[model samples]
Target: MSKRIDPDNRRRYFIVGSVILEIVTPVFRQRLEKDYKSKGVGCLQDFINSKPVIHILFHLRHTNIKCCVDSTNCRNRRKLPLNYSQWDLLYTENPGPPKHHCHCLYTTNNVKLDDLDVTLASLILLNCCNLTPNEEISIKELREFKNNYLSHNIKGAITEKEYQTLWNDLMTYVLQLDPSKQDDFIRIQNRPLDDSLCNKYFVCLLDIHKKLEEISDKLESSTAEILTAINGQSNMELLTKLEEILQYVRCQSPKEKTDNHGIKQQTPIQPYKLGQPIVTLHHQINLTSVVNTSWKVTDISMMDDGRLVMCLPVQSRLLICNTDGSQVESIHVQGYPWYAAAVNNSTVAVTLWGIKCIEMYDINNKLKLKFISLPGIMRLDSGITAINNKIVVGGENRLHIIDYQTGKVIQTITTKCNPGRLHGSGDRILYCDNINSNKMYWYSYTNARHHNLTLPSPPWDMTILQNGSLYVVCKDGSVQHVSSDGKQYKPVKTLQTTPGCDGIHYNLTQRKLMTIQNKNRLVTVYNEI
Candidate 1:
């Protein structure tokens, strides 16, 4: 009389176990061996056998960790004292007379790649090991996967879409660590999860749960001692230390409880309010070297992977660039490309000028997916955004919502003036008509109402921040900040450009803003201060 495990949960459990055991551990082992060998240690096993105590002490000192456990308990438990420093969860003392015992974490007088687990491997990589930039990013992402996803997933379940997304992200990280193991990972992902395999994975899941609980207990027991250690520091330094401590504590905390309907209720994120603008120039990329000097970037959008998609009307192409404006690639479109919006991680929807068609392209493959033709709308320009699996297209004096999959117009809204540029989030759509008015309009999908906010000049392009507030680039070489509800506004940043700023995009993940200026030949990036 036990509840049956959900199929999705079984798959998730299998993925988690196989990824940690089959991929992560081996990669960590390889890196550790390489790092030690480069330091003249011969091999990892030789290093561990020769200087176990030194190895443990070196890492503790490297990470600036100190043991807070009492001396009496430390002696009884065979733990290091406060002077030698200790990370209780990471290292342990060898079985011997307490005074003569050596502390070790990697392995006890032996090194076996199969003996390493996700937690131990991750700790070693993050705290004690040397890593390249790519390897560092990959390991940190894997750590986040453990802290955020696996620890909180009490049910061991994931939806189909969630599984695909997680698979792609984790695979990317795995390849970054060691590209040769791609086939091994693929086999693990495709392996069938029979009942025996499920049971084994369930045992691994229980062990992870136990480890998480131990982490939480240690954090709770050491908070007071940690705070005391940071006493007398400057207020800013103290606050920063406290915040870091709290962040780790929160990550180790249990998952939130579900409501009556068995759905987890998440606290809504508060929208950022406009204040004295704290923006600084981060980078300026001149596109004149890559493209014709006269060709202009009429619009810009940020993809999920942090790349920028820009519209080149005169060139009739879509220009793609890395987050730093490197690795530039161009896709030729059939007509003049006036605007572009990212539909998903790999897809972008482009609006062609003087054509009543919206072209969806797979940027990764650099090929057109489909064209959605609007019957009544004669032309399309810089007014397009993807929201809730639908594409909102702006035409002469109206907005059309088209189903991206079916290529059918599902809803239409008549506007008082022409809609030029559009952006949407959740149930709201914001648009501006640079030709007809200097006013921006916000439309509610649920209530079917319109709200307007007047600006100093016509708005050319806009992007929303994580908190729902917007950064709007205007026709007067100025950028404005507006509240979520469009009730308040302020001028935040301005560009020194003639013919005004035509394109703008905010990368919420990076907290950076990209704007096109100098007739779209110069691209300026700003960091949020």
Candidate 2:
């Protein structure tokens, strides 16, 4: 019998709206929408339950992507969810009629991290090239850990007893990063040591792309030889060696660098032309707090029904206020909440520290619906967003996609570095990695990482507009505008605050940019381009 390649062993999948899609035939450009029972838009649960095949040939080597949603399985038609949400307090419900007027409000300034693992828990201190003593020691420890654990295993050091020991140590490191663990192993370590090291090592490996390019040259030559051996049928043993080498070479291909901003950039579908300002400041508001305690505005969003939601991490409240910043209603939750997003007009998902779970709450009733516990030490370092009826959250190393209804983790996307504040639009996910000097990584739904943008300063949070423009608030008090093409980005506006900007949002219905200042405790509004 001929050796069979198991069909079920396929590795990658994509959840588009209510559809579960996998590239069934990579070469033929065919995709299979995994048949599921649900009729409405597919959620993360559908993706988790479906068996799919992963086709590596789908990986893109050029800037142009040649892929499409196979419509054969798309039985239901639904609106492609808005990239940015809308809010209009005057109209009482979200997605209300468009108004030309701009509004701003003061948000809390007492931002505090309840745990070390939450997103933006600590801003990376930069400007100096050398590492801190503690940071250096942590990096050294990471090298030792990798060698003692992974390196030895790869080198054939796998006795059953040794394997168990290695597994235990790996789990120990994972647990320490998990929010549920509060014992001595976590307390004395300050921020998770493993996380710190991982981020540092990633930065140190910035030259990895250069190495990959060098290896790609060798791989090309070896592949040609392998093809010849296959034809001759004489170099079977040599062919096997070449295949092994090719596998390792294919791992991390060189990502193209297109801009001076950071590591790599992709050629935009349509590059932006440099020109006059497309957006300008419209209004500013200085808010006075109703509560006596200090608070920090960590994240912001517009609900479908037009309410403005801001996450007060220190206050453990999801502050809902009108556009003009009057009369605020708050929902209290246990532990400190980092960020929040609207699942719908009536429901919101909040990422919590200490508890280490993302909780879904009924915003109208202010009732806790249920919580989904995180697996391993996955830290939701970035606040959460609802994309295509699923929760999009990220930490240092990965992005977690969860089913909004079930609180089940449907899929996880690995990131290049420690991803902090992130925003999602359709299949494109944009995130900032403070550990890598505030590098912005853009990931498409089909592939792992698409492109990267380096910012002048560490970014606190980002918001995407309806037209695909990206607005990022940096620690340097400047808000940058990246054109839809990703080729042009400039400081569109500046804040007078010292500590600089933190939370940001782009209201699609109103066509405005909303940003919160960490130092001044003020909110600023700008007319969109």
Worst 10 residues of 1 by lDDT: 68-77
Give all candidates' CA lDDT scores: 0.66, 0.48
* TM-scores of the candidates in the order shown: 0.53, 0.47
Residue lDDT tens for model 2, 308-386? 6777778778876645564467889787777778776557888776456788876545678987787532464654677
Global lDDT for candidate 1?
Answer: 0.66
Best by lDDT: 1
Candidate 1 matches the true fold with a TM-score of 0.53
- For model 1, residues 393-499, the per-residue Cα lDDT tens digits are 88777888888889989788888667788888666678888774788887876567888888888887787765567778777778788887778888773443565
Report the lDDT of model 2 for residue 283. 58
